[model samples]
Target: MTVVQITLRKKRLGRSLAGDIVLFGLLALVGCFMALPLVFVISNAFKPINEILKFPPDFFVRNPTFTNFYDLYHLLAGSWVPLTRYIYNTFFIAFVGTAGHVIIASMAAYPLAKRKFPGKTFLFTVVVLSLMFSATVTQITNYMTMSWLGFLDTHWAVIIPAIGSSLGLYLMKQYMEQIPDALLEAAEVDGCSEFRIFWSIVMPVVKPAWLTLIIFSFQGLWGAGGAAGSMYIYSEQLKTIDYAFSQILSGGIIRTGPSMAATLLMLSVPILIFIISQSSVIQTMSTSGMKD
Candidate 1:
């Protein structure tokens, strides 16, 4: 190559490298900013009360201790309802709601993705539009519907609504679209029922999407029970972990340290769920191979 071309190429490479460096630096700064509160929560959980409440509020713990966790345990043990009941309620809602949502969303998504039917396009468009609105916007109407169905104050109030989640439906339908139509056609040729094809074929192939949906549904339901839950569930024994944790945190200055520790404990489940599901999600994405 001529020296001019080589110099020009060198200049382009230098500018590109400079731009990338600037981009990553900015990203790193933003990442640190976003991570600061999480770091504070983790560190504060272990910090001695004096250190945590110290002037200027240090970012890192000067003296770490497990006393906060111990205190949190004692506090929970003193509750009228057993801690197990709260835990059970949380897991029941999270697991049952997530399972129902995944199955129902997948079933709805398959036909939307693969089949052509009258009003199918309009139905999907409505689902997409639903995503633009937040659940809180429909609170009054949802409450009336729940009351009408006699689902108020029951676990069904939470699980039933989750089954019709718009985001989950949208994501599953999009993922199902990537699955080969030829595969479904071949299965049909073998006289396989739609349910059989979905359960055995579409499900295994769309593992990533459903795993992702699991993480979303589980996390949401796990920490749910605020407005809707509080309104419906008046029975203390049926209250979720979130309600119990909120009570703990509201215990004022004396309980701040324990509340931080409790927050960490509460945060751990969803983080672990994401970590495990994320690995499977990545694996499924990498291994998904389809022929036209």
Candidate 2:
């Protein structure tokens, strides 16, 4: 190669490196900006009541204390309903709802994605259209349906509705479309039943998609607190941990520290779940092969 060509190639490489560095720096800045609220929550959880109520709030706690956590424990302990009961209700609903959502979504998505059938286009269109409507828009309809089905004032009211979430179904369908038809065909040629193929082959291959679905579904159900159940569940014993914490938050300004502590405790579960499965979530989002 001539020296001039070599020098030009070197310049291109330099420019590419500079562009990459600039992009990385910008992304880092944006990430930090997004993380500020999370950092502030963590900081406030450790702050003393005096610091929490200071005129100008400090970003970091100067006098860290565990008093908030202690207060939260005592307050909840004094409630008529046991703290363990609230915790049990929350976990039961979140886990059961998330599991049902993942299974139902995946099962529905598989056929819509890989098989040709009558009304497939129309059905998929309905799902896409459903995504445009917020849960609030369908609240009255859902309540009526639950009432008709005799599901009102029960855990099933929350679990059953969450199981049919359109978002999870849509995401699974899109991700499943990326799986090659050849794989399913091969399984069928070997005399594998549709259910067998779905459970064994398709499910294992689409692990990332469902993992992402779990994160989304669980986060929604977890953060929903009593709102999802409030309309259906009137029994105090059936109330979730979030509902209980919300009571603490409503206890005037004096409960600010404990409220912050409760907020952190509530957020910790979802954040931890996301951290554990974040790689799968990223993989599912990044590797889609769907074509318009």
Candidate 3:
């Protein structure tokens, strides 16, 4: 190649190299952003109580110990956690709440998306209006309703109001809208009942949406109101992990190192679940359409 041609090629190569470096750097920055909290938690979990408040955080745990985990589980000589109980309560609440949300929300959404009925416009309008206010804004009323229903201080108390939420129904309706009408028709033509059509045909196509709801429900309940109000099994045995954590914190025993460790451990499961759930939540949301 001529000198000018060689110079031009060199210039292109330099640009390409610079572009790659910039792209990689941006990705690394994002990765660090995501990992920083997790890294801090992991390090703190291993440290002793004193190191957590050191002038500068002890970035490394000089002597790593699994004591935090044991203590949280009530497994050590001076144990505090009711580990198995918390695990059971959390999973039970999370699973039931999630499953119910998926079922009831999708059931509500299916009709909103596809079928027309009496007072349809009015009902939808009301739902839309309610969306303007969130759970926090309505907490007092919700708490009162739970009290009236004799569900207060019980697992059902938490579960009922959660299943009443519009968010999941809204999301499901958006997803159900993306399902072609012809598919429902085909299911009907094949001698399927409405229930079968919904169970076998409609539901299969909305797996991504279902997955999204599951993750959302799990994460939401694990941290917030999901496990907060259950009344059954009054003790460590009945309380959810979130509730247990709250109890610990409330007792004014915030072991910085162990608290950080326990918190990080508690946070890890949902993070992993979210990573697994992102694809579906994104896909279903991206494909869903809004109604007029």
Candidate 4:
């Protein structure tokens, strides 16, 4: 190639590279702006009332302390359960709920998506319709059922209902539909049990959906919905993090720093999980509903 031709090619490639760089830089800047509130919460968690309240609150802490953690423990008012127990309860509920959501919901969805069963279409339709319903919308009836089952005052009330979520089932069913019929038939010919095929074949193919469900279940349980049954369960040793935090904030006037500190801790897990997992989740979901 001539010298001028080579120079032109190099100039075009450089300009293309520079444009891509500018595009990614703008996206990163937007991401930072979107994440700024979480940054504020984390900073406030380590700060005192004065710093958190400044006219234009600083993202950097002036005087950080472990006082808020201690202050939270004292809010129990003569209880012996300790703050750690509350964390344990929260973690237990979150872990079990997330696992149950993935396993049970996927199991329930697979047959609906791939197998013929009595009322299968009707069942899927009902589940899809129910996706629009929130727990708060059915609280009165659900609470009554809890009373009937003697589950009203137990952790099971929250855990059990959370496992019944339709959103996970719907998403899983949609993902399951993407798996080829030939794969399931081939597994059966090779003597794989239905459960084994689902575990090894279907589940592997929908890993992105599973990860999304994991993050979602954790996020949802960490929010207000998982705390609804805390009214019945928060008897000292049984309190979840949300109930404990609310009880602490509601008792007369609280110093803003400690309250904000507690709030930050309450919200930290989901924020961190979403930030870490957002990319892979989007990619998986984008491809999950397509035909084989």
Candidate 5:
């Protein structure tokens, strides 16, 4: 190669390496910042009460112990209800809520993504716009409606609303749009029913999308306000793990160590779920809605 070409190539390579180093450094900083809370949760779970209360509390555990977990067990052992009951209630709600939401959202999304129908544009527009409104902003109105429908203090109040969530619908619709229209059209020509096509064809192809939805739905329902709030669920048996965790936190200064343990326990499941399903989520999210 010419001397000028060799020098220019070396300069470009050096600049590229520098840019990469800077980019990765920034990413590492952000990752550490994001991980701080998780590290704190894990480290503090093993810390003693004194360490937790120590001024300028250290982020890492100095001397770890299982006493906190032992104390947490004994504390919950004294509760009016068994700890298993709270766990059961949380899982029941999470599973049912996630299943119902996935089915309904996928069904609704298929029509919006694949069909030409009356009011389709308007309906989809409304769904998109609804995402702008937060639940806290509409809680009063929602509660009033639920009360009028005699859904107050019922599990239905939580499950029904979540089943129709806009986020799930939006994600499913965007992903469904990526499915080739020609395939669906071919299925129709073979006399395949729309419902059959959706269940047997579309649903199978969009595994990544629904897996993403599953992660979202499960995490949301597991930590839902309805599960913990006294207004919607008054029955002790119906209250979830989140409510039990709140009770632990309210146990005051003496139970602070256990409370940190409880927080980590609560966080672990969702973190695991995301870690397991994150590959699918990233793949689908990156390319969804890009098909013509």
Candidate 6:
């Protein structure tokens, strides 16, 4: 309560406040920088074809119009494959693939995280190493495996491989490790079977991890157009909306307006999903490696 102590405390508080202000100001600047592309996409979608193709393209639209969306709708309506069919295929694959990835990855992760077993370290190590390899590196192997399994030209070719994604398994395992061993032991003592403990206890506790995994899996599947569709899907009706939209975008310079509209439509779903699940993702990341 002395004046010196009070003055010193006031100085410390002032410096801390200044630091926090600077930190938050920098974060805001960086956030806006990162958001520019998304804002540009939205702006371009509403722009007239003339603005889109102007000598020097403007970042924002001068005269926004719905003509682009109308053109896109009419073009899709006149396509050989029904627009609804394409939408259905995209949703089916994204949903099924994301669900499968979350379940299978969580199941695989549980044992690797909590159970002691032979080669457990090696197995987890392999999963970690696999993350270093890009999908393009395994493209040929996946194709051959899918062909051997008679999954070629089928939705299974995409869904099955995604279900076994190493990234999801790795993330789930890391999250599960933060669960206390005593908690699981208590569940076992209370007559909970291994599956029951996993489903009832572990899964609920690690919900944020799997929710984050769902976002990753869904985005990947939703955006997959060329690699899976061109290689594995031969039927137009079975092709995803992304593939259909991609075809529209490739229809030369005349289709610019509609292409921009299609681009916006395609980007909207994954962005919405991320926005909804982002809180869970932040929660998972914050405590990912910490133990109870």
User: 265 in model 6: Cα distance from truth in Å?
Assistant: 0.6
Better of 1 and 5 by TM-score: 1
| lDDT for position 53 in model 1 | 81
Better of 1 and 2 by TM-score: 2
| Candidate order by decreasing TM-score | 6, 2, 1, 5, 4, 3
Identify the runs in model 6 with alpha carbons over 4 angstroms from their true place.
1-15, 283-291
The TM-score obtained by model 5 is 0.86
For residues 1-292, could you state the per-residue lDDT of candidate 5 as single tens digits? 9996899898887787678899999999999999998998999999988899999999899999988889889888888989998888888878888999999999999999999999999999999999999987767777787889898877777777788789999999988888999889899999999899999989978988899899989999889943335757788777887787787668679888888888888899999999989987677655543343
TM-score of each: 0.87, 0.90, 0.78, 0.83, 0.86, 0.91
Top of the candidates by lDDT: 6
| lDDT for 268 (candidate 6) | 97
Clashing pairs in 2: 153-232
Candidate 6 Cα deviation (angstroms), residue 29: 0.9
Better of 2 and 4 by TM-score: 2
Q: Could you tell which candidate, 3 or 4, scores higher by TM-score?
A: 4
Pick out the ten consecutive residues of candidate 4 with the lowest summed lDDT.
225-234
Candidate number with greatest TM-score: 6
- Write the residue-wise lDDT of candidate 3 on 173-216 in tens digits: 87788778887787788899988888887787788888988888
* Per-residue lDDT of model 2, residues 142-188, tens digit only: 99999999988788899998999999999989888878888888899
Cα-based lDDT for every prediction? 0.89, 0.90, 0.73, 0.79, 0.86, 0.91
In model 4, how many backbone clashes occur? 0
Error of 1 at 39 (Å): 2.6
Comparing 3 with 5 on lDDT, the higher-scoring candidate is: 5
Q: How does candidate 6 score on lDDT?
A: 0.91
Off by over 4 Å in 2: 1-20, 282-292
Task: Give per-residue lDDT, candidate 1, residue 289.
Answer: 60
Please give, for residues 164-266, the per-residue lDDT of candidate 4 as tens digits.
8899999999878878998799999999999999899899788888888888898887764335645546466766877777666776545566687778877
Error of 5 at 91 (Å): 0.6
